[model samples]
Target: MVVAGRIHRRHFIIGAAGTAGAVVAIGANGVDAPALAQQTTEPQNGKALPEVVSWKDPDAVIVHTELTVETKRDKIGTSGITPSTELYLRNNLPSPSEEAVANRDSWEVSFEGVQNERTMTVGDLKRLGIETVAAVLQCSGNGRALFDHEASGTQWSTGAAGNLIWSGVPVRTVVEALGGVAAGRAFMTSTGGESLPEGIDPQTVIVERSIPADIAMERAILAWEMNGQPVPLAHGGPLRVVIPGFYGINNVKYVKKVAFTETESDAAIQRTGYRVRPVGVSGAPDQPSMWEMKVKSWVTHPLVDQQSGRIQIFGVAFGGNSAVQRVEVSTDGGQSWREANFVGPDLGSYAWRPFVLPVDLSPGTYTITSRATDASGNVQEEVTEPNHRGYDYSGWRRLAVDVTVT
Candidate 1:
């Protein structure tokens, strides 16, 4: 029973940078069916389908990317959060071989960064103070599937995000063990020659990116197992990079190589695509993408219960660099709101804080919305919050349901 190391704690403020509006607490209100429908619009190019990825059997259905709102609704009653089993899969390339996805063979990962260059198999990685941590891995375009203005790439439903307990070697030790490479200022990750995926654009599939070696060393990891078992091929198998706080694209899968460099390269996903202007800014210059986590929250429990009685509202919040200062809930469509009490104050940034709010329902329809505010006073917005590329960071999530009293 080997366990991976835990994410180190730091003093990161909760919430985002710029925000407006005052925080207020209010009681439940009547629902508006037409208003809710108008707020959520359809994508431009008709309706898109959920792209499914599988390794072993043709029916594996490992991951689905660029999904549409209708597809998400048909699959899961909720959209924002995808289940671990049905988690939409994304790979730089297809599986290297059928055996890699079927056979439960051991794996090996190499560490080549500015400090030191070395290679360690899965067994060796597990022996070095192995630990497991539960964190959220969300695509930068997770909610893009819902945006009225469509992005060129994957039309991901909120389902592009998943929370799993990942196990592997601590990236800090991997970087530190390499005599701490001095020449390179950034860390590069690669995978073995045997495991590259098939049919993927050679240029776009295999991932490689470099961040300040110091930053990568602080939170990087060679993840070998996910959710208490070997990571499925649909996800990254054998090994993957679990860098908390950054977009899912930064966490490269099927890693075969790692390097350290003094200068950043625009060859990888972070350099060219998946990069967007920060929140609240319009037409801002694009910057090299790094793992910048914003304070975000979502409501999961009772997403839409037709047999509604005394429904209990529940969900989780996470901010890698900052702590979730407050999580607020609104049943009146953001016009009025109430603060949902945190499980406690001592929760960690990497760990999610589960919140519970019991609300009594009447014989009518309702819309449940949740918002998060970080310690830095960055409050979640109700709409897109007006970003440059229309990239959605943290915003209010609304769940609709109709009720009838017997």
Candidate 2:
């Protein structure tokens, strides 16, 4: 995949002129300026960084203006598992170096706040055991583009999510073997080893975020594989944390360290970012961090301008921690609804379930909406309150199409 603003190893210093130069000039005693410069200047064996995966069918997805990738609503329901190539990409920072991606085997993950406090390699993790699970990985800010409040972040729609099968060792097993977590630690903060650009202070950068310790020990996995293939560089190769039923932000990619803390991580990404607050409200402690995803569904079969006599509309529904009980489709702007037929076997609680509805219509304009009800009875809201960060939008999915019965 070719990302718009591709950064090469050679370009690190030049690209980060302002930040790198400032860091070099400051040369703080505690900060390792020389090491930072060395990292920036090191050549990647003269090889360019790997290109981030891009959509083969441009029409199949919507490429954000900022290059944050998202699949198109109409192209999503074709398969129960979203293809690795078709999966959306969301990166808080630039991609890691090609060298880093190539030498993944040597990478070690350190675990802290445990009785043993040990480090483990991917091989060690596999030796313990391999477990595969199908789960949804969704951006917290999905559907932000549709919000009327105009939040400041990636303006995503329904395509900012996908259901994929992941293969890895359960986090609980790993933690238990490491002498188990110490008491009083309620959060597990994970960090990636990816190098940062020149100008930014490594300490200030928020590469890590914390999740509840219970969730980490329960449903989280140290995933190294995606859809039977090794995790791609763009999708956090080597290893990543996959927390089923949680938003994607908690699934830290390129994981290097897992620290058990008594309190929530104060990293910028954890504290100041990804919070659900009012448009004007801004502060770390005031806003709540986004966690479990809300029940949501989208119409994917009929393209916006699709023309047909008998249209079959289908989409995927996910209820985060709960199983989706039913999905209802409305043909008349949600004035009424009809239960849609589920199309596939239930993968799991974390995986999305597909639903389809067949409708016959003459030439006219139509608005279609889909709402999902989970086992917990959490129904998709008709409207979601707009937040400052555009996170956790779980409203009824809607689509407008012009049908021509020729």
Top candidate when judged by lDDT against the true structure: 2
Write candidate 2's Cα lDDT for 136-174 as tens digits. Answer: 999998878766666787778777898988989998888
TM value for model 1: 0.70
Query: What are the runs in model 1 whose C-alpha is more than 4 Å off?
Result: 1-83, 101-106, 187-205, 277-290, 305-309, 342-347, 385-390, 397-406
lDDT of each prediction vs. the true structure?
A: 0.52, 0.72
Report the number of the highest-TM-score candidate: 2
TM-score of each predicted structure versus truth: 0.70, 0.84
| Candidate 2 CA-lDDT value | 0.72
Model 1: per-residue Cα lDDT at residue 155: 56
Tens digits of per-residue lDDT, candidate 1, 1-406, equal: 1011111111112232211111111111222222233231223333322322211111112224332121232232222222344345555444455455454445555665544566666666666766676666776665554454545556554445555567777777765666766673555544333343568765554466555566677776778787666775557776777776666666777666766666654454545545566443433115636456667776654443233356666666666456667888776556678888765434345555666677777655455667888777877655553333445445554222222221
